[model samples]
Target: MDAGEASVVLEEISYFEAVLRMLCAMLVGIVVGVERGRNHRPAGMRTHMLVALGACVTMVVSNYLFVEFRPLGATPDPARLGAQVVSGVGFLGAGTIMREGLSVKGLTTAASIWAVACLGLAAGAGYYAIALTGAAAVYATLTVFEVVQRKMNVTRHATLALDLECKDLSGVMHDLNRFSVQQNATLSHVQFDETEERGVYHLTAIAVFRGANPQADQAVFLEKLGGNLNVKKLETTQY
Candidate 1:
């Protein structure tokens, strides 16, 4: 291209425009993070803000490279760089997920992190409407709609109090998680009480089961969980 065309391309993103995109990205991120922070999630306000800002910076740099190096016969794909951000952000999301005792936490936080990244990309790409709307939708899902569910008294899960006695403690939690998955149950809470007798420990947990027949599933869950030689006894009561 000629000098005039190259100059026009170079001036596409002025300093002001770049700053605006970055700031918008942060605003979008903050909007989404507020709900997470309020809920005491693993990835809170600052973490989401940083992820959004970093994604915006990445896009800005990509646009800059495309404009500056187009005159030098350099074939740089900005979308490729953006794709890296999409995939690479998964590691950050994975960091938020955690297993404690018998329960798993931070799935929602991980999803929020991914949503924040998308909002940042939208802001960076100058799609302000999409960014704002997406943030609003996420915020509503976290708050307003949740309140509606509570008011409506939606109880889709069947909670069960579990009593398990095991001789072998090793891999007990792992086995519990595996069997819960098999029975389509989620472990929300767990407690371990060891008796004076050696090699005997009591495992108690609240398992939320989801199925057409939760009561029937309970018996099957117990059978699978106690099938192991290490597990001596298992009982469950629906609540």
Candidate 2:
């Protein structure tokens, strides 16, 4: 074959291989993404799939530059490309984490994104089995483990931020103490912030319940507080 024809054939083969790698990465990402989607996580199927595809593209490009464009006697290190993917994905994961009052959400989602990126790297490197296994493990953790955790008596505490406007501090404190006693919750920490508009008291409490019932109790607490004339704006947080 002519040199030009040979070069064209090689380019076509390379393009086909890159596309295959991207498809494999996307499939693995979707496997992980389905689990996140079922849990209503912030970074769902589409987000994970895109991240995996992007990682695969980066890995493929890096591999091409190292293997095909080596200069003189210098050997290119392909592993460095994988390392870069790990660090670069961190920025994307950070965007998923958010602070809502005292509680921060999307941590699990961020971790899942990181996991998906790793899967992409594995797939890009032609380690299909490893990538698939990792994605399966992630799915199990998000599905089975989560259910088991919810069933167990894990002392998962969530913080609630309450902003109350009362006529005076004395009346508000009295009502708060009474409410705590009734709810079987102890006020672990309390802080009062007084402004011109009203007096704001932030209460951090620990409520002991049999199993997963604290969330329901929190809703009831908010409802009761809202009904009271002495209370103002109340916000609840779970981290």
| Candidate 2 residue spans exceeding 4 A from truth | 1-16, 156-160, 165-189, 193-239
- The reply for model 1, stretches above 4 Å from the true place, is 1-3, 148-155, 158-161, 164-239
- Candidate 1 has a TM-score of 0.67
Per-residue lDDT value at 23 in model 1: 93
Q: What lDDT score belongs to each candidate, Candidate 1 first?
A: 0.82, 0.74
Positional deviation of 183 in candidate 2, in angstroms? 5.1
Highest-scoring model, TM-score? 2
RMSD to truth, every model: 8.0, 6.0
State the weakest 10-residue window (summed lDDT) of model 1.
153-162
* Cα lDDT tens digits for candidate 1, 1-239: 65467679668678888899889889878988877898889888899999888888888888888777877877778677778888889999999999864458888889888888888888777777887898889888888987898888645667788888888776788888888888888897688988777979998899888876776776787777778888878787766
Position 7, candidate 2: lDDT: 54
